[model samples]
Target: MGIKEFMISFIFTSILLSILFIPTLLTKSFAGIRPSSFSGHPQASPFPVSFAYLISASKGDLESLKRTLCALYHPANYYLLHLDLEASHEERLSLLKFVSAHPIFSQVGNVWIVEKSNLVTYRGPTMLANTLHAMAMLLKTCKWDWFINLSASDYPLVTQDDLIHAFSSLPRDLSFIQHSSHLGWKMNKRAKPIIIDPGLYNLKKSELMWVTKHRTVPTAFKLYTGSAWMVLSRSFAEFCVVGWDNLPRTLLLYYTNFISSPEGYFQTVICNSKDFKNTTVNHDLHYIAWDSPPKQHPISLGLKDYRRLILSFAPFARKFKKDDPVLDKIDREILRRNDGQFTYGGWCSERGESNATCTGFGRHENSGVLRPGAGSRRLKALIVKLLSMRNFKRKQCR
Candidate 1:
C-alpha cells in the first residue's frame, strides 16, 4: 500500500491500541515476556551497553524514517525521532502515530518525538545544532551509555540485541567517530571559507552564501574534521552539551560560522579536550563507499554494493536510495524484520507463541538478553581490529 493509505490505517490502529493495549501496559503483573536466559548461544556476547538513538529526518522521508525506526528498534534502547521543520505537519503526525500505535513501542514507552522541530539547512551548522538538541533531551529523559546519531538514509546492519551484546564487553567512555586532523584539501575549501546558512533566518530553502572575506584558523584549539555521523558516549555528550569545562562551549561558537560544521564541530571539541582525546575510536561505525576521487556525496548504495556492505564488518551503512532492494534484502535476511515489525531480538517474545508473547516485559526485562547474529560477529571483528593497540592508539585525532 502507499504511504498515505498506510498512515490512515495506522491512525485507526493507534486508536484501537489506546483502547485495547492500555490495560496490558498498565499492569505490573505481566512479566514473563522477556527471554528466559542467555546461557550459551552461537551469537551471544557479554556486552551490557544501552544505546540512545537520535534519528533525524526531513521532508519526503517519512516512509524511510518509519522503516529505519523499525529496523533499528530495541526495548533496551532509547529513541528520539525528529522530522525537521521542512516536513509538513501531516508527515510528522504520521510518524508520531506509527510510533504510538505500535503495541510494543507503546508498552515499552522508550520512544520520543521532537514536537518543536528545528529548521535544518542542508550542509549547515544547523545539523549539528539539531543533533545537540536531541542529545540534550535524551540525557535529561533517560540514563543510557551510548548515543548513536543516524539519518533516514541509513539502516542498521545488525539487530539492537547484537549491538548491545557486542558493546557489553567494551569500555563505556569510547566514542566511535571517523576523524582526522590532516584537513588536506578541506583546509582551503572548508576551513578558510566563512559561509552564512540562510536557514538560520530564512523561511524559504536557499543555498548557503559565502562572505567574501576569508577567516583565519583559530589557534585557541586545534581543528579536526570527520564524517558527520557518529556513535558518541553519554559521558562525552554530557561534556559537549553540559560543558563542565569551556572547551566544548568555545568550539561550538567557533564552528557557528564554519563550513560543514557537522563534520568539524564534534571532532574539534572531542580532540581538543585532554580528558576526551584518548576516548576516541576513529571509525564512524558505518560502511560508506565513495566514488573514485569522490564527489560531494558518497555513492547511493544499491544492489551492486551489497556484497561490500556486508563484508565491511560495520554495524551501519548509509546513503541508500529510498526503497532500494538492498534494504529489502537486509530487512529479510539480516535484520529478520517483517515489513512493519521490529528487528528480531530477545525482547520480541510474541513472534514465537502468541501475539503478546514478545510483549512480555519486566522491571528488568532488558537484564541480560542479547541474541547477536552474523552482523555481531562482523561488528565484533571490526571493533577488535579498531581496539588493537597499534590502530586504536595511533589514530586518535592525529
Candidate 2:
C-alpha cells in the first residue's frame, strides 16, 4: 500500500484500539505514587520546571547510551530510552538489567525503556515514529514542561540543575527548533523524492527504497526543515500526538516518503499551525561541529572540541565516540560527576557542603532544592540572547 493509504489504515486500526481501551484507561487506577524515599540526601531541585527526554540509540551503542543517561539523569526529569530494533536481544536485556539494577533509578522512578523497539531506518519515517512513540509514552506517564530528544552519542554540557534554573524564567510555550523555509539544495534532493522505508513493516532493517516517480513540493502548507534535535513544549507535543486540527496527521503522511522526516516533521507541523508558529526560538540547543564540507554525518567530537563546546553554551553536544577522553574531561570539569554516578544536583547533595556526594533522596527538607552553578549562569546567558528583543521575534518561522 502507498504511504497515505497505510496511514489511513493505521489510523482506523488505532481508532478501534482506542475505542477498546478508552474505558479501561479511564477506569483503571495507575501505579501507586511511591513516597519520596527522602531517606538519603534530598536530591530535589528548587526549580519547579521539569523536562522529559527521549534518548534514541541503535546497535553497538549500549556503553555510550549508559554514559549519556548517567550524565543527564536527574530526579526531577523524566527519561525514556529507546534502543532500536536493530539491536540484539542480549543487548536489550543487558540494558534493561542495568536500568533495573540502578538503585537511584528505582528510587526516582523517572527513567523508562521502550520495551518494544521500533525498527529505525536512517533518514526515514521510522526515526520520526520512534520519537513520537516515546513522546506519547512520556505524555501518558509523566508531567513535564518540555520534551527534549537526544541520541546516544549526545552528552550534556550542563547538569539538570543548570538546565532547570535556566529555563525557570522562560515562557513555557517556547520551542527551540532550528527551522527554515528556504529548502535550497534540499528542494530537489529531498522534497521531491518518494522513498519507502521497509523498517516500518519488515522485521529486518533495509535502506530507504526510492520510487521511479517524484512528488511535487507540498503547497497546501509551507514546508519547513531543520535540525532533528529539538526541545518541544508539552503543549506542542500534545498537539502533535492528539492532532486536534489534523495538520500534524496530514504532514505525517506527507513526510512518510520524504527523506529525513525527523528533521522536518515537527518543523512543518509547528510552523504551519498558527498557534505554534510564533513560539519558535530557531535554535536546536545543541553544540555540534561539522567538517568544512559536511559529510553524511557530523564530525565525532573529541578533546579538541572542548573549548568550542563549552563556549557555545549549548545544553547538549552530539556524535561523540564511546569512551572518548573528552567525555571524561566533561564529567570532571563541567558536570563534576564521579565515576558511575549521576550528575551532581541539588536533590543529591547538602546545601552548604562542597563536593558532596549524592547519597539519594530524603535527607534534604525539600525535594526542590536547586544548586545551579556556573553552568546555569552560562546557559541563562545563552537563553537571554536567544529570547532577546533583537533576536527572538525576528528568528521565528522565517
lDDT of each: 0.77, 0.81
| Model 2 Cα lDDT, one tens digit per residue, 1-398 | 46676556546533422332222232222122222443122234444788989998999999889989889988778778888888988988889888887788777677778777778889888788777777776776667899999999999999888999999888999999999999888889899987777776688988777766677986799999999999999999989877578787778777777899898989999999999999999999999888877666999999999999999999999889999999999999889887788788877787676583554654562647888998999989998999999999998888
Alpha-carbon runs more than 4 Å astray in model 1: 1-47, 350-367
**Per model, how many backbone clashes are there?**
8, 15
TM-score of each: 0.85, 0.90
Alpha-carbon error at 337 in model 2, in Å? Answer: 0.3
Give the candidate number with the greatest lDDT: 2
lDDT of 2 at 46: 45
Tens-digit lDDT track for model 1 on 8-111?
Answer: 54344234222321222223211112221231121232336678898899999999998898888776677888888899979977887777776776666677
What's the TM for model 2?
0.90
lDDT of 2: 0.81
**Model 1 global lDDT (CA atoms, 0 to 1):** 0.77
What ranges in model 2 sit over 4 Å off?
A: 1-47
